[model samples]
Target: MAASTCVRAGEISPGHDSFTGSPSTADRLTGSVAVDGQRRHGGSSRDVRRGRPTLVCPCLPVVDGLSSGRLDQDEGVSSFRKGDHGEPDSVRFEAAGLRWLGEAPGGVAVAEVLSEGPGWLETARVHPGGATAAAAEQLGRALARTHAAGAPHLGCPPAGWTGDGFMGRAQLPLRGTPGPDSWGEFYAADRVLPYLAGAVANGAIDTAGERTVRRCADRLATGELDAPQPRLVTRPAARLHGDLWSGNVLWGERDGIVAATLIDPAAHGGHAESDLAQLGVFGAPHLDRVVAAYDEISPLAPGWRERVGLHQLHMLIVHAALFGGSYGRQTVRTAARYA
Candidate 1:
């Protein structure tokens, strides 16, 4: 039995996804997450499907993978949840009065200390051992509520751009945007292109493959990609959990729960649907329920499913960067079939 660190600076570990030597994980961790305060494992996607783990920590929101942040160890109520496209960067430790400290010895620093309530984190729960259709509907409604939270005041820049995705700092330059004008531009620049460079640098992809990414990025940039105008948000950019997948959705029937804040986010602003589509891609529990829920709060832009292949390619490329070529190949296949 081994344990893994996760979804954020390694705090939200999966049951068996990451193993560090022996069957046990060291309790001590660096930077944030208030080391040892609480170890919350939101179970795996399968667990959620069965309707187990119905009880969710109101303070913790479910999320996709992990990441590292950029701040040195300090203390405050992280305005955002530390994360990236894959996993969390830094673990955050917050003291009273909004003081925050962080540690991401594993990677970069991910901390946006803030003390306010997390309305966007949204609801997350796992169905430890049950399967109820109503639970699915409940989850659906909850997600809709999260999307309806409206744009909040911004603090840090909305970003998922990482130099790590590049070959030894051979970063792909994205046009400077204090923030993006639309979700399409933001996703194209940050998620799609940068990860392709990282995959090339990591040897998962060749220069030729990288060219495809450039082609894709260029298309979106020029509005030439054969696709509809993304339901991409323009004004306010809108806060989004940079990575959203099946594991991020927790299945539970929490009464009176309006929404669950997005925790462990590679937080930024772009198409909120990015999260929804991702959920569908990874087969998040009660996916139909979540979509139904989202629709109630605010309807989805049409033809969202068809774009899954397009959005999922970004995630696969990211995997290639962090792991290896298979993900790259998978990405290429998807691109050939879709956008």
Candidate 2:
């Protein structure tokens, strides 16, 4: 029963300046946790790779096994450990999402993934620092490139990803329906309404709030929110981080300045605006700079600003489903704007 050290050298700090972006928050909203312990042993790199699980409990024997010393030397070992209820396949889905999006042409920077199994995942640890305007701008351009990578269709999962996906702890279906023919329809059916229904079922939303959201859905169904395109969306479905809240953005210092590295992505294919709007969810630093830079490279549609709330509705309802508090009220208020 050795106490687990949640962080070690090269690990992201647990503070406002770290991954969560909230200086006062504790657990990561992104649902990632790291485990390590203090112990030393002599083993080859392969031995360390095979011995990572033992590191989760420092009390384990070191006589013939792995150690952080060996792992650190590898320079590619993930700096954290996590386990779920014996269903490790979810971690594989997440790992695949990271690789598929990270390797896309001109993709945004992402945390390096070391390994993944049925119920565990390891990723290269990142040490975070303060945000910089330059870093925000760079992130914007990088995000533009990522979104521009495009996808086979809206609601498509990352290449090689199997089964339904997730956003934070909530299930996210990646399978797209045929003949939707418009972004508004895809979003209303696949993103907005499903979470809205969950929120209602869970009593997170009141009758009045549900009515407001339904009105918004009706508008979406009629394609009232579709950009200037006819029969098709004006913008193609872009690769999305799926969840881009500020906490998931790890800011790191390099050469005495700040830059961002993404982690815990719920990556999928969706409207690029969905990603952009989510950045402002908990509020990322230098947000204006990020948006300006993004516009410079891949300008948003005319009236995108007016549509920000539309895109944000999905996450807001998700929060209501998972937390069931102020988020629910906010969902109604946001939907009212469109209603």
Best by TM-score: 2
TM-score of 2: 0.75
- Highest lDDT: give the candidate number: 2
TM-score of each: 0.54, 0.75
lDDT of 1 at 109: 20
Those runs of model 1 whose alpha carbons end farther than 4 Å from true positions after fitting are 1-89, 93-131, 152-177, 224-235, 252-263, 337-339
* lDDT of candidate 1 over 174-258, digit per residue (tens): 2324455544565677667766756787787777667666666666666444333223233353344445543443332235333
For candidate 1, the per-residue lDDT at 3 reads 31
The candidate 2 region of ten consecutive residues with least summed lDDT is: 37-46
Clashing pairs in 2: 16-23, 78-123, 88-118, 88-119, 89-118
* Over 4 Å off, model 2: 1-78, 176-179, 228-235, 254-257
**Candidate 1, TM-score vs. the true structure?**
0.54
